[model samples]
Target: MKVLLILADGMRPDSLTNIPQAQKLIKESAYTLSGETVSPSVTLPCHISLFHSVTPQRHGTTTNTYAPQVRPINGLCEVLKQADKKCAIFYNWEEIRDVSRPNSLAHSCFYAGRRIGYKEAGEALTADAIGYLKKYDTDFTFIYFGYPDWAGHKYGWMTEEYLQAIQSSWDNIEKLMAELGDEYTYIITADHGGHDRTHGSDMPEDMVIPVIIKGKGFDAGKILENVNIMDIAPTVTKILGVTPDEEWEGRALI
Candidate 1:
């Protein structure tokens, strides 16, 4: 089976301590990396860096307003599909509104309804993810959870609301992972870290996010330093016995 990547948008390194479930998860099967994100930590550009394995400036998506373009760079989904493996995305963002893109990425794509804020929108996203859990038979799944980041961006990572939101998201993720069991390797990461409710800057707090991996397939009990967010795509494809595109700037962590 391929890996399952859960991307929590706008999540911070400090927020990791608040979620007991995630903390326990880290203690168990965690191969955590202290990852640095590309500049412009907002959703669209950050996601571009994540998928394309390049800096936001190189990827030409330096802001939320830019339409996603994937030329001169290929993402994990493209690599997986070319290798004859199944890939799917349960996305809740507008950048992927183009139906053709998701269809090309996966055999099936599930775009759940969107919401305004993190908590308000995530309940629907979680349920949508749970439903997709039961239906999809794909080898790889990418689920995006966007509350902690929302709270973090609006209320700061150290605030009570952000902590609570982080915990809640982790609780939901635990349920999903428990149900899936060892059928898939789970990789949880954030696009970027933030502080004082802002990203898109070169600050340490905004650049470093946590990369948590679990499941029997993972090495476990490992810590990586100075990792790059772009590295995840290559690492995931490598685990599935596939080669990443030449344009990708990451190397396999495994």
Candidate 2:
């Protein structure tokens, strides 16, 4: 089965209360509101951990800066490509480009969130991603929305503005699902949550993330347990019928 990953950066599970789309997803998917992200809980490091299925200590990217891994490990895209699966990525953030190695991706689309602003970038990227998904037949695709994190940094986490960003991200999610959901299993999550105006602390607000799995294999309306961001890659590889990297520390959920 093809898998599509959608991420809303720095979104807190508690902030989904008022979003109609998000509420519908929570009731219809196998979900965990208290899934944990790797500490540092910063964007780049947590994502590296997610894709590589290991801790930042193992991957060696402790900050937003892309540090070369001393002992590199295959990420999701790399592993998928090795199995002859086509992979694509659509993202607003630039730093996240390093998550997958060169030649691993069959296609990639990026909108500069740093220059045009994350909100605008997310909007444009979502439209383009939807178009691409409708036209293409990629085995694995990842779509990233930077709005929530940018909003969290600008207006405190859980504030109206930040919640609005989360809602906006969900609007895009709903659009994609409405059109192309039955063809792909959708996995939605966050790299990290936030507190006040900043994150990276080990506080629950920063570390706890929400994970929603919606598709044929996952049980609808079921509450999941012991979920972690690193588990994502293992689960994806499992769904795609590919072997996980030997160094991965996470176990597949299904």
Candidate 3:
């Protein structure tokens, strides 16, 4: 099965509930608004846990700056590559470039959110991702929208700006679903949430994220339990008909 994994960085669960498109997705998917994120709930660390199916302690990256894993574990992309699945990535943040190791991706597109405003960058990245998906026989694609995180840092979580950013992200999601149709399974989640103007905390606001899965075998409108950020990789591998890496600690949602 083809998979489209969308990550809206620092998108709080509450903000997702406020969006109409997100609510509709929840109604049509197996979702959990209370999915637990790993502690030190920052962007890169949480994303590393998501891709590697391990915690920061295991991955050895507790901060935004990525360091080579002390004992490398196969990330989701690496496993998919081994299985001969074509993968692509579209992201606005440069720091996320390390999510996949060398030559793991069939295509990648990056637009710096800081150079052009985060909102504009997200729009551009989404458009590019749509174009690429239409033209390629890709098995997996990751689309990272950085606007919500940028807005959260600039205007504080739950603020008007942050809510608008969430809305904008939903608009993009709607576009993707409409264009791609139901041929692909869509997994939408956040790397982490935020509190005040910053994150990296144990507070519920920072650790609670939303995981929404729309695809075959998922019960519509079902709210899941015991889901974690680390579960994402195993779930993706399962969808692609590949074995999860032995080092991965999370179970597949399916």
Candidate 4:
């Protein structure tokens, strides 16, 4: 099965129900899995953990920089491509553009510079993702939206504006789902959640992330437990019948 991995950076579980479109997706097509973030809870390590199915320590990245390459020695993109599945990415964070990882392997990759509520930038990222999704006809696509997390960092997690930004993202996601139809296994999740909207530290809310799995063949109403961020890659690889590397720490939800 194809994978559409939606990374709504820094999204809290509590925010899902607050957005009508996201809420409908949660109710109709998906189930939420409780998960955690790696230490330092930042974007690079979190995303590396996601693709490699290991902690930041295992993946080798501690900060957002290109050095200290820890995890993702064998990224998900490489695995998927080896299995004859096309892969593509659309992301807003510049830190993830490293050549050592999945971003480099995408059939196409797009990024927007740092800044929250930059409507033109958001539109650019969204348009790129949609374009790649349509153009590649890939079996797997990963779309990472950074505004919610950036908003949370600047405006705090519980603020109305941050929530509103999430709502707008939901609208874009809806467009993606509608266009893609049932051809993919869509997984919507976050690198981490936060209380004061801060991560990169050990905090209960900051470490916890929400996992929503949906699409044509997944089990609806399936509530998975003990799912770590590290498990996501393995789960997706397994479902797609690809062999994940042995260094992965996560398990398939199914």
Candidate 5:
């Protein structure tokens, strides 16, 4: 089964209430509002844990900067590439480029949100992703929206600006789904949540995220428990019939 993984960086679980598309997915999919992210609760580290199925301590990257793994373990993209599954990525954060190894992606598009406006970058990335998905038979596609994180950092979490950003993200999600149709198993999640004006804490406001698994084989409206960021890779590999790396510490939700 093809997988479309969408991540809204620094999106809090409670903020999903303001996003109609997220609420619809939650009502129609197996989901958890209390999914746990790794310690440090930072963007790059959380993303590494999500893709590598390990903690930041294991991955040795606790900040936004990318670092080569001391003892490298295969990431989701690497494993998929080895299995000849076409993979693509569309994101605004350049730091996230480290999630996959070089040459592993069949298609990649990036727009630096820090330079251009985050909202514009997100919309353009979504449009590009939709076009690429339609043009290529990609097995896995990762689309990341960075506006929420930018809004949170600029205007604080749950503030009017942050909620507006969440709304905009949902608008993009609705557009993407409408264009892509039902050919993919869509997984929507966040790398981490934010509190006040900053994160990187162990508090629930920072560590708690939402996980929505919507597609075939998953029970609609099922409420899940004990979901972790690390579980995402295993779950995606499972859907694609690929074996998880031996070092991966998470299990498939299905």
Candidate 6:
């Protein structure tokens, strides 16, 4: 089965309020609102863990800057590429480009969110992802929406503007779901949550995230427990019938 992973950066589980698409997703997917992200809870580090299935210490990316792994462990896309899967990425954050090694992706698209604004960037990205996924047969795809994090940082986390950002993100998600249907195993989550205008702390406000898994094998409305952002890659590889990287520390969720 094809896998589609969508991440809304800096979205707290409490921040899912009043979003129509998010409620629909939660109602239709097996989800956990208490999923934990790695310490530091920064964007690039948490995402590295999500893709590599390891913590910040193991990946050595404890901040927004990318750090080459001490002993390189194959990331999700690399492992999928070795399995002959066609992988693609659509994102607005440029730093996240290092999530996978070179030559692992079949296609990659980036929108300059910092320059053109993340909301506009996300619109262009979501449209491109939907169009590309429909026209071609892609085995694995990852789409990142950086607007929420931007809003959280610009305004304050959980503020009206931040909530609006979350709502706007789900609006894009709704559009994708409507256009693509449910052919893919969908994994929706966040990189990390924020408190006030910043994150990177070890507090629950920064560490707790939400994970939603919607697919054939998952039971809708089932409340999951003990979920982690790191588990996403393993679950995706398992769903796609590909092998998880040998060095991955996260377990595949049932």
The candidate that wins on lDDT is 5
Structural similarity to truth (TM-score) of each candidate: 0.89, 0.98, 0.99, 0.90, 0.99, 0.99
Instruction: Please list the C-alpha lDDT of all candidates, in the order they appear.
Output: 0.72, 0.93, 0.92, 0.75, 0.93, 0.93
Candidates 1 and 4: which is better by TM-score? 4
lDDT at 204 for candidate 2? 98
Relative to the true structure, candidate 3 reaches a TM of: 0.99
**Model 1, range 167-230, lDDT digits (tens) per residue?**
7778768877877777788888888877787777888788778888876556567786557888
Off by over 4 Å in 5: none
Candidate 4 residue pairs in backbone clash: 59-70, 59-71, 60-70, 60-71, 61-70
Listed per candidate, the RMSD to the true structure in angstroms reads: 2.6, 0.8, 0.7, 2.3, 0.7, 0.7
lDDT of 2 at 202: 98
lDDT of 4 by residue, 83-164 (tens): 7777777777777665234333556555564654444456677777777777666777777778888888889996887787
Higher-scoring candidate on lDDT, 1 or 6? 6
* Model 4 TM-score relative to the real fold: 0.90
The C-alpha stretches of model 4 lying farther than 4 A from their native spots are 70-72, 99-106, 115-118
CA lDDT for candidate 5: 0.93
Task: Tell me the lDDT of model 4 at 94.
Answer: 70
Across 60-120, the per-residue lDDT of candidate 3 in tens digits comes to 9988999889899999999999999999999999999988899999999999999998889
Badly placed stretches (over 4 Å) of model 6 are none
lDDT of 3: 0.92
Position 120, candidate 4: lDDT = 48
* Residue 183 alpha-carbon offset, candidate 5, angstroms: 0.8
Q: Taking the tens digit of each residue's C-alpha lDDT, what string does model 5 give over 1-254?
A: 79999999999999988677888889889999999999999999999999999999999998999888999999999999999999999999899899999999999999999999899999999999988888989999999999999999999999999999999988998899899988889999999999999999999999999999988988999998899999999999999999989999999999
Weakest 10 consecutive residues, lDDT, candidate 5? 16-25
Cα-based RMSD of candidate 5? 0.7
